[model samples]
Target chain A: MRRGLILLGALLALAACQQTPAPRQALFVVLPGDDGHIGAITVNDGKREILLDRPYAASESRGGVTAPVQTSEVEVRQVFGAALAARPILPVHFRLYFQTGSDRLTPESDAAYRAVFDDIRRRPVYQVEVVGHTDTTGVAARNQDLSQQRAASMRDRLVRDGIAAGAITTAGRGELDQAVPTARGVDEPRNRRVEVTVR
Target chain B: MHKFVWAGVATLALAGLAGPAMAAGAVIGQVKTVAGQAFVLRDGGRVAARPGDAVQEKDVLETGADGAIGVTFIDNSVFSSGPNSQVSLEEFSFDSSNFKGAMTSEVRRGTLTVVSGDIARSTPGSMKVKTPTAIMGVRGTTFAVQVKP
Candidate 1:
């Protein structure tokens, strides 16, 4: 009876020790300030660090060493806080230009698209949520279609550039979700934009 | 003689009209993946399949209105169909011990992405997606299929 009791106690102790605590995985968003500068950000310990280096000058090619501007720490706690607050540091906005009543992308938007592509390419594993919007200058139905097409075009470009298409989700908000509210006939440059969130 | 011939001609025309009305096909399932649009019905429930579903030879599949579906074959390969697409499974068969079969699908419209799975690697040329414009045969890679209506 004594042996049995001791064995039972040992088994209970082992069970208690074997129990594993769940991992702490939290989502965070990097919110850029109005000046396009990211404030303090948080990330998990195991999460990979993002290196932000300044663009190399043409003369820097001759030198073997390139100076980095700064390094930011991404902590899990901050990530959790931001996720709770529903904001991100690097918020992307695309101003897609069209030939007046068409969904086709114009050449003027190419440079802007390249910038977006470069941002995505810099971080491969990041998932993106794309919301397309348009100015209220056109018919409601037409605006809806145009916005969707614009979002799709951006998605295709990203996919072609070797980004996983699955990681990106696209939605056309039409003129319903406007950045800058304007009258029906007014042209709102900010409204004709696509917002991309990388988290 | 002339009256009898006219009656026979009218009967044949009526049969033709009735045949088309009775030949309507049913919507078996829906597409639930990105850029994919094919699905199959099993046990009265829509199987939003990944590439891992065990398939036998001659399984009939169809796409939902969105024209996107996901499938995982026995070998764990994933594929998805886009919206407004339709694909009929021409053939499928697999066994864990012996993984070998052929799968042919017809994409009537929309887009599809085939991510090479185990089946494509083990038995090359066994998987083929036929579009209205061309037939896509998988070697072992990710490729998209788009058919314009």
Candidate 2:
């Protein structure tokens, strides 16, 4: 009976140690975005609020209270290496310029579009949004048609490059949305362009 | 368990009616990359996740000790979770015209990293993450969360 009691006491002690585990913790860290800009984060734990605005800024909340702390890239990598490495490909944007009053791509833009096409090909699954714009030199209605033609032309090239037809969407903003605001009937090279966003 | 089985049946029926591409709920994102053992729990059914798989709202992502998964949302928001993590997409919506949206995710355990996108940029504080101990709000930023089990 004495031996049994000793065993029971030892088991109870082990249980006590197991039950007093470390307190639950939640850590939040802010980092620079893909665009190289740092934004802010707000953490609320019902009873308190903490703000982390700078890159590598960090905080830990325990038992519903939080406080800010210093962190470095090395620490972040040590803790979140897998999660960071698993980050998805960042969205890419391309602007292809067009010749004045036409849907034909400028020589420079023609070379640029090959890079965009190659990027789209590399992704196993991609969604493309092509928006075309025209300079203010032409009539609004005509510019709208020309802008749409420009977008459609780009879409056709993507389709020929083997992108699924359903994966691409096109829009024509025409002179209403110019890269450079200009007086009516002004020919702005920057405004006559097609913007493509691939994700 | 019975409730989950029934929910799975219902989801299967809806998928048949609407087709896979137009799966019952709104497809908020896609699984961009998955390594090792990862699965998406939807409507009580656990499906092995693969690249390009559509991720709907309310789906739970589970990653094993050797697993990791990345997701990219319609609003360009990107997120990924490390091994042994359970993350749930509680709510998500986006308006392409206005670039306004709200996203709320829950990290039950393990680590998650996110890069806020157009939605968070256009409407600061609209994106949030909930943990066992606290809630995090993103204001057009990149952030990471680690929830200890």
Candidate 2, residue A4: CA error in Å? Answer: 36
TM-score of each: 0.33, 0.83
Q: Provide chain B TM-scores across all predictions.
A: 0.57, 0.85
Docking class of 1: incorrect
Query: For this target, which candidate reaches the highest TM-score against the unseen true structure?
Result: 2
Runs of candidate 2 with Cα error greater than 4 angstroms are A1-24, B1-11, B14-23
Per-residue lDDT value at A60 in model 2 = 86
Q: What TM value does the first chain of each candidate achieve? A: 0.51, 0.82
TM-score of 2: 0.83
- Residue B130 error for model 2, in Å? 2.0
